[model samples]
Target chain A: MRRPDHQTTTLTAEAVLAPYLREQAASFLRGLRLQREHSAPADAGTQRADEAARALRHAARRISGTLHTFRGALEPVWADQLRAELAWLSGTLAREHAYATRLGRLLDALHQLSGASLPAARPPSGEGASETDKERAALGVGAARAGALLERRLTLARTRAHSAALQALGSSRFHAVADAVALLASEVPLSPSAAEPAGLVLHAPAELAEQRMLDAVAALPPDEAVEPYNEAHDALWHQARQLLRLHRYAHELLRGAPDPALVGPGHALDLHRDAAEAAAAASAAARTPRIAPATAYALGVLHADQRHEVEAARGVFRETWPHAAAVTAS
Target chain B: MRRPDHQTTTLTAEAVLAPYLREQAASFLRGLRLQREHSAPADAGTQRADEAARALRHAARRISGTLHTFRGALEPVWADQLRAELAWLSGTLAREHAYATRLGRLLDALHQLSGASLPAARPPSGEGASETDKERAALGVGAARAGALLERRLTLARTRAHSAALQALGSSRFHAVADAVALLASEVPLSPSAAEPAGLVLHAPAELAEQRMLDAVAALPPDEAVEPYNEAHDALWHQARQLLRLHRYAHELLRGAPDPALVGPGHALDLHRDAAEAAAAASAAARTPRIAPATAYALGVLHADQRHEVEAARGVFRETWPHAAAVTAS
Candidate 1:
């Protein structure tokens, strides 16, 4: 929603938040319409469907984040129920993309290392071309099988996710959520605090969100102390990513736009989360029962690469923390 | 370009490629119109502008790629000149996005690690919350200034790129290329070789492209031997990516779509290129004269993060090469 030209200090919480809630709810309905009209329910899916899903997710996230961050200014019971429903919808929709991205990343890795374009094995020579040919031949072994294995496993997972998502969208639970959001578009369930000036009422809650995010980031083990590809640290960073997002949403509530200070870090944390999840996917694929040793080896390498990405993101966070701290101080 | 269902064997080279080239050229013109009409040249860009830029880039790339891959099937002089012009336009337009992405990545890294949301400082303690607060304060020092430095540098670069893109779009060179492409849509510049059946003449060239890609891959030193984050190796991988793209375009010319075999590797190579370039950007940022030590430290970490991403992508490509080889052999 566009920000009011007048100062936020003069506005009521209802004035600031009601329009946003209504807009997101309306957006959700529009997304649903676009998705249904553009694609067959039983079909594999299309770019239009994907775009609709993204719109739905974006609206759902903003709504969910708003409810969570601004809970103190809303009717508690209603807010909690709606927040839970939004989370359910968001989680269901996210699964397919997660599986798809992981599969793409793994398959791409396999394709890059494979020599499907190269000739069959040639005699090794001292020159550059020969060395490449030898390496290509060595690495090409069992690559097709590996690709097939990953494709089969991940595709199944993605198809399942898609079905689950479709089912969820059509279910009574989703309809109820939609009904509630539709009602929200007409009337937000505000508490006594909503009567206060928007700026004054919202400041503490936003601050709390920031404090939580900071606490989470600070609690992480120093980069050097953590083992390379440490799962425990990875989990913490994922949690930190969520906290940062909450802080960002809260910041948006306060200022009308997402805090510029947090936007960059929020994006970096997103990359961290994706890398961690992808690494986990590779690890899972590697654990497939009685897979070929070469397939396993390739999966292992894929896993390691993602893990390094995780560490790299963490290093960036470590470097960036000071700027965030300085912003807080100011 | 919707694919024609009939077997490619019956089609002549001109019969197959002329329509595709025409569609891409029209698409390019449409993108240019969308860009010009949607926003004022003097204003900071909008989402519409970005979308237009992407459309333009896509069309330019497809045209250039097709020209290179299908050179033997067309008038060589006409094709080469057009290809060169398309490359120039693509590169010029690419600079703004590149700088923007680099800036976003660096800034996000800084934001994620900063303590902008935390309290200024706290006494150190063994407990989790206390540990977090202490760490947040430590990391926040000079982060704001570092962010400022990077923002200034990258934003300047992006602005310059934007201007260059705009100037290129308006230049006579671009107009000449556009005119040639417009004429091409009606009358394809054909060579005597174009008389051959599409499948007959295209095979060897596509095969040759693949062979060159494979040879490049074959030329690289063994993975273990090439030290991690090796620049020379990164450059080689970049070249391999181009060669792979040429083969992919060649394949698409023969078949109706891109080789499924190469798509996955192509995406991985794209990531490799982006990461390598981002790493270079960070290194350059770190080298800014008279910057604070803390600012330099943050940039160094950012540089390291991107370098690791580069290596990670390389690892994926390594694991993927065999699949490419398998497809090539078959």
Candidate 2:
């Protein structure tokens, strides 16, 4: 996809920021409402409320991302503090949502794997199904149990997140955010640079994001697979994930109008980040003491599977980055 | 689906049993091969091994089911012993597969829900995507986390399963099973009743299975939803599940030649059994202690959701059975 024109990108940022912030603020509020609804007696079902939680998280993220991308346009202190507050809110909602989603994702991936899996498992026809069909059914039963375990853990996490959200809702900072949102157009102390016409907004953040991604990749040891369990490996992966996240959000600033080439990498990068995160979770689960021996065995399987996926994702990223770089380089 | 003609169904049973047993034994051996392959030096990938594990499970189940479904034809002592060992083998394989599958199913369901879900999470997007699309992306992140948590635990369960499988393959009982499978056709324990024509074969098992299913369902409390928690509820659900399994097997004996009316109810019954099992799992998960408050809350959400599904299944059963009764009665 051709690079979006820089001149238009700058104007796009200026034109969109105020409305964008308002929309984000509105999204946050909307999510907050659903959060409250879930804890209430009404049977709104978790579906809506879950979306709300995600909305609040994404809005907060984009808000922060926008502030960073357009830092020169606003007062430094105000942006910093507001960003902090939004981060808190996002983190709060993310806590439970993250766990719940991860549990869901892993379970799904395992089953999906079951479908095309293990042709040798094909049962002799007089009794049952062919390989994957029968195995898939059996896996379905096990997946239920695994899901149950996750649900228990995720419920507890969500309880804590909701509590945190409630506290934040009532805090002075929350009030300040609300007031700031109400007067967002006038309150953001715009500087002379805010009016710059050359419009480096989209290109600037994208360029910064790519450099950071490259630097993160550079910092990695020659072979992560050698001792991926170590702290350095984990920290480096985390740093790269954050950089990738920044890049994704930077692209989001294109307001869905991003260069077409950017889209695929955005998804690929998310997968890379998630695979790394899942591998880490698998390792941690392995170390959790006093679990049933069977449970321990299962976790080990999950860990190995995830570790393999992590390696695959890294490979994917290595392959994907050059294309993205080439597209944007021109 | 119309109930299958019992005349043809009876013929199907006779044709299927020997081949079924042979196929099951073959499946068992094949699965054993994959299981060993996994623990070997080269990476065979967990997907293949996992399928192997499940194949072992289904093979054992079918062997046991066939022995039960055709009990009169085989030697009483031999059948009992074989059933016992197969049950043990099946249970061993199942302990791990069940956990893995449950994890996958729940995570997948949750993510699917996330996509059409979290309506309030609709971000104000100038991007090309709609509300659900954007919300789904955000939910994807959270789902990834939830999946990670499950992957950890499932890996542990699978590790144990593999170990257990390795042990079983080396056991005296396993050896006996193998011997029995090898000499299955030549075994001298056949009763004169084995030649008693097709009269007693099909309908007897069907009648017996239906009676058992009905008995188990009758044992369920007047209102299952009022209190699905206690030991009795669990035991009854388990019994019903087993009965359903038998019925499904009996139906499979008919293959595509089933009594036309049996087909719909067969599928419905499978769903019924699954929903009930899932609900039980959810309840158990909810009872597990020391989870975070958020996790507990999430468990409750899962518990409630499964409970509703269970009740819905019950309703579906109630609706389906009457139609089946009318059709079969005629």
Say which candidate scores most in TM-score. Answer: 1
**Residues A1-330, model 2: lDDT tens digits:** 223555344474455455566666677667667766774425322687777767767777877877776677667788887888777767765776666656666665444433333332222233223322432443344344444554555566656766676677678977787666556534455555555552544466566776776677676556444222222244455566676666666665554444455455456557755765554454344334444423333333344345445555565666655544534522
How much does each candidate deviate at the interface, measured as C-alpha RMSD after superposition? 15.3, 17.7
Q: Worst ten-residue run, lDDT, model 2 chain B?
A: B119-128
User: On residues B302-328, what C-alpha lDDT tens digit does candidate 2 reach at each position?
Assistant: 333444455555556555554344224
My TM-score estimates for the predictions, one after another, are 0.50, 0.44
lDDT of 1 at B72: 80
**Model 2, residue B231: what's the lDDT?**
23
lDDT, residue A311, model 1: 72
Candidate 2 lDDT at A9 equals 44
Tens digits of per-residue lDDT for model 1 on B1-330?
435534556887777778778878888888878876764665446888889888988888888888887888889999999999888888988888889987887677667556444333232333434433433343345356667987899899998988888788789998897798788767788788787787677666777888888888887657642234344356577788888887776666666687666766788899988887776665555446565544544453455456666766877877766643635522
Judge candidate 2 against the unseen true structure and give its global Cα lDDT, from 0 to 1. Answer: 0.55
